[model samples]
Target: MTPSAEILAFMGRLGHDFARPEFLVRALTHGSIASATRPDNQRLEFLGDRVLGLVMAEALFHADTQASEGQLAPRYNALVKGETCAALARQIGLGEVLKLGRSEMLSGGRRKEALLADGMEAVIAAVYLDAGFETARRVVLNLWRDRLDTIEDDPRDPKTALQEWAQANGMKPPAYEQTGRGGPDHAPVFHITVRLDNGETAAAQGSGTKRSIEQAAARTLLERLEGRE
Candidate 1:
């Protein structure tokens, strides 16, 4: 089937022409709108996640020959995390082309991080299937060019780093608590506070998820403890 002008335009932004337009269509379909005759992007999202991982791992492996696995692991995670995928999707206006159910649309699904991230992965899978691994790799590399170039040498997760710092200083493991929550149920904001045994603490708020807020709080506290902030 011929792709609509909208899909074609999205393809232009994605830098890929679909040999099988149906794949792109399937990738954009959300579970909320799926039916017996229409499949959701969940399966495609799963496949795309692996494809993205492989592409990122290979790229990171070649980008820094001297970097050890311990260093590369965090960098890879930073590059391919759900937040990064969602950011990429927003950059390319992928949310504009998402085919969501009425309920999802009413709930502002297009702007949702999880939904956008899942869609990004599905699109990657679609590209991998439509062309080949080489083409998919090229597309991914192009999309992530800026990030790949400027990725930190030690982009460790804040929680892990904070835990290590606490342990090294002879302090007990840090504790995190939810101080408050606000906003609508569909997209609530989480307020998290991280505190060490020594009474040092930091608080952060985010709509990305409780875990993300916790990470942010940890980062804040860690930076303060290390005199970086």
Candidate 2:
């Protein structure tokens, strides 16, 4: 899709406008692709991670007047988790539009949750810097309403969540296929294929975001895929 149309659709879903179209493009650029394509989004990704944390923490802390410092931690974790970000990316059709390196593309980086999740955060950071704080808040909060909707007021380990779901369904705990790795020798994205006893499978991309979170998504996707079996 044309960048203009893509940005418009993203903005429509996000309920905000780009203060600078350039930031949006830069945010969309991935390191894998940017080495050849142009500017990289990794720097933007770093900025967005902090911006999202601050904004989400602010919203969680202020939205509920009675929440203790302890109560807000879990809520923040759930909201900023990689799965949440990946869901947001899929919502905006980011997967289909990402410009990835040939190796990353061949290895499924375009559909990798790690990449999508990081890209979304980078986009948020870019929006905030390009526009302003409130605009970024509007965009992030609007899409993350579901997270706010189910604020348990505490943190729950997603790995635990997956185990609970499995046990509830009388199924064995999930198993992960450690497929391979990507990125530089020092930093690598771990590829895992989650499978269940019910003959279903789904892929997960795990890395520095949190190994447990990626495992949870893999487990969740495995169960989701199981329903179709």
Judging by lDDT against the true structure, name the best candidate: 1
lDDT of each: 0.95, 0.76
Q: Which regions of candidate 1 deviate over 4 angstroms?
A: none
Q: Per-residue lDDT of 147-178 in model 1, one digit per residue for the tens?
A: 99999998878998999999999999999999
User: Lowest summed lDDT over 10 consecutive residues: which window, candidate 1?
Assistant: 220-229
Which ranges of candidate 2 are over 4 A from the true structure? 1-3, 158-229
Q: Worst lDDT window (10 residues) for model 2?
A: 206-215
For candidate 1, what is the TM-score? Answer: 0.93
Model 2 lDDT tens row, 13-59 = 66666756778788888887775547888888998988889889998
lDDT for position 37 in model 2: 45
Q: Which candidate has the top score in TM-score?
A: 1
